[model samples]
Structure formats: structure tokens, C-alpha cells
Target: MQLTGMFVHPLKSTRGIAFERAFAGKLGLLHDREWLLVTPDGDQITARSHPQLVRVRVELLPGGILLHYEGKPPIFAMTTVFTRPHRAQVWKDVFQAWHGDQRLDAWFAAILGQECRLLWLGAQSGRALKGGGEKMSFADGYPFLLVNQASLDDLNSQLAQPVTLRHFRPNLVVNGDYPWMEDEWQVIRIGEVEFDVMKPCARCVLTTVNPDSGEKNPDGEPLRTLVRTRRLEEGVCFGINLKARNEGMLQLGAPLEILEQRYSF
Candidate 1:
């Protein structure tokens, strides 16, 4: 199999930037899910809870980041260092995240109509997933999730409207044989690096958004399909959540091989 597309989400739940090549970090991909919008209570806001967040588009520029959403003027923020008063919980661990900029937050709050805060994952965060003898930085849950083009094609064939791979929000997109084949992949090797497929990523409401247009649609379309067809004992299987067994840079167009077909964990 070969890598087809790669993406990095500079901020969680916002539009992701497609890349030809990206550095793989403990967190998954560089600048992927490294920033997030949160409420005053430090709860992370996602398209699941706040569908309007889908309207937010994030672009990483040379000097700073740009955010544009429907019905609002674009906002730009420099990549300056701003510290949070206290550590906040994104998922399980309390992480020290920097708020992007006050003005940007104010603008978003005007739309969100709640006291919202922005948090950027920093180098000093020292946050990681705990358990299962695996480690991950700041991804929603898994370090890396990979999907295949054939899988999306298969799903699209069942739907009236075809969905793009962006609907799945995977870090790695590959072209391969069977639909949802990556779900059975236990270990895959790219270049000299090896990765352990830890789990099947569970489908969520985020899949309902059209990433390019940031429009929300009925979750039933995809979620219902996945539940009926791809449901596993663990969750609705779609892609494989991977943890690096050996770290290395995964270049674009790198050939991927399934080194092992089964793993206990």
C-alpha cells in the first residue's frame, strides 16, 4: 500500500490543512490537534457538542495562524507565547495550554455566546496518554489513525452523496485493497519505522461535517451506515488507531507494508 494524503489539524475541531509531507510526533502528526477551543470550565468544545464550530477554518501561515468562519471577519493571531492561568483537562490529563490571543477569543465568544477559551498545545505540556504500554501526545485519543481510499469509496457507493476521506479526519490516508481493510491491520511498517495498530477508531458526530464547506449535515447518514455495517464489539470500526513502535519520519508516498496481521493489544 502507499500513502495517498496527509493532513494536520492545527486546532481541534476546525478545518485541517492538507500536507504533502508532515513530521510524525508522539502526538500523531506535527501541528495536528495541537490547539483546542474550550469553555470557561475547561471542557473541550468539538463539533459533537458545538456544530457551529465546524464553520471555523484554520490556516497555518508562515508568521501566524488565520481563522475564518461564516458571517464573521477573518481573525489573525501571531504565534506568540501566552500562558494559561491553570492547567486544564482536554480529555483525561490536565495540560498547561496557552490561549492563542484574547482578541481572537473575544471574537469567538461573541459567536459562541459563552465564555470560551482557546488552548494551544505547547512543547512543555508534558501531557500523554496513560495505560496499555502505549503513549500518545495530544490527539483526541489515538496517536495516529489511518484509513484507506477504498474504504471511503465503498461507503460512498452505499450513500446517495459521496463522502470524502476528510469525513473521517484521519492523519494518514492510504490507497489499498478492501474497504475498511485497515481495521484488520495490527502492525504496519513505513520505511524503517513500525507502528502497532492499537484499536479501531470509533465514529462520532464529527463525521457529519463537510470539512471544506464546514456545513453540518445529519449524522444519521454516515453514523447509521457505519453502525449497521462496521460495528465491532468495541465500536463502529472504520480506521486503525496506531501507536508508534519505532519513531521515524514518514515521508509522503512512502510504501506501507503490513508487517504483522495480529496483535493482542
Candidate 2:
């Protein structure tokens, strides 16, 4: 299978930045989800609650970030230094994170129409990978989420109105594999990097949200279909979460090799 798409959400649940080539690291591609937004109480905020976050554009810059939203000039913040520690909770893990500043906080607050602040994933972020000992960035769970094109085609065949790939928010998309081939893949190599296939990525209502308009499907599609087709005791799964075994470069059109395989389901 060859890698056909590479995406990075510089900010979680926001617009993704497509990359032709990226430097793979322990957490993921260098800038993937290195920053995030959180409520003043230190709770994480994402598109699940405010789908409008999809309209926020994030551009990774050296030691800073550039945020663009419609009808206003882009806002830029340099994070060379951090403020006092702010606790951020994701799933079951909690870690101390650095808040940008009042100006940065106010910028996102206006965009989100709520009291929210930006948090930088710095030395304070120590969320451990599920199986691996390495730390991670602001990603919800794992470093990488991979999807197979064939699997999406199979799912689309069942949908009345097929959705695009963005709604699923995969970090990498590969072709030339059978539908759901990643489900059984234990280890794979993309370009020069090796990754351990950790677990299946579960689907949720977030899948029903339109990636472009922030509109949600009232019928709860793909997620509903997946429940009937791909459900397990855990949840409805679409992609496989990956933990990089070794850091290297990953690029579009790179051939992926199944270095090892162990059928689980």
C-alpha cells in the first residue's frame, strides 16, 4: 500500500494542514496537534461541543502559530515562553500545560464565543502512549490515526450520502489495501518510519459533523452504519491508531510495507 494522503491538525478539531512531506517524531509529524484550546477550568475543548472550530485555520510557524478566521485578520502568537501551569484533561489523562497569554486567550475566546484559552504542549505534556513509553502531544489518544482508502469506499457504498475523508480526520491515508486491512496489521512501515499498530480507532458522533459547514447530520450517519457493520464490544471502529516505533520521514506516495502481521479479529 502507498500513502496517498498526509494530514496534520496543528490544533485539535480545527482545520487540518495537508503536508506532502513531514518529519515523523515520537508524538507524530512535528507540528501535529502541538497546541490545543481549553476552558478556563482546564478542561479540553473540541469540535464535539463547538463544531464551528472547523472554521478556524491554524498555521504552524517557528516558535509560534498563526490563526485565521473569516472576516478578520489572522492572529499570531509566539510561544517562546509560557505562563503558569494549567491542567489539561483528555480522556483519562491529565497534564500540566502552558497558557499562551491574555491576548491569545481573548483571540480564541472571540472565535469560540466562549471563555477559552490556548494551551501549548511543551515539556509539561507527558501523556504516555498506550503501549509505548514515549510522550505525546495534544492528540486525544494516540500519535497517528491511519485509514485505508478501500475501507472508506466500502463504507461509502453503504451510506445514502457519502461523506468525504476529512470528517474522519486521519493522519495518513493509504491505498492498495483491502477494506479494513489495517484492522489486522500489527506492524507497518511508511516510507522510512516504522509504526506499531496499537488499537482500532473508535467512531463517534463527531463523524456525522460536516467538515466544511459545521453542520451535523440529524440521522447520525456513517457512525450509525458503522455500528451495524463494524461494532465490537469496544465501539465502532474505522481506522487503526499507530504509535511510531522509530522516528523518520513520512511523505505522500510513499509505499507502506506490512513488516509484521497478526490477525486479531
Best model number under TM-score? 2
Clashes found in each candidate (C-alpha, N, C closer than 3 A): 0, 0
lDDT of 2 by residue, 8-28 (tens): 998899989889999888888
TM-score of each model, paired residue for residue? 0.90, 0.95
Instruction: Give candidate 1 regions above 4 Å deviation.
Output: 62-64, 132-135, 263-265
**Per-residue CA lDDT of candidate 1, range 83-171, in tens?**
65545576676766666578877988986778888776665555657665444455777778888889888988898887888788888
What TM-score should be assigned to candidate 1?
0.90
Candidate 2 global lDDT: 0.86
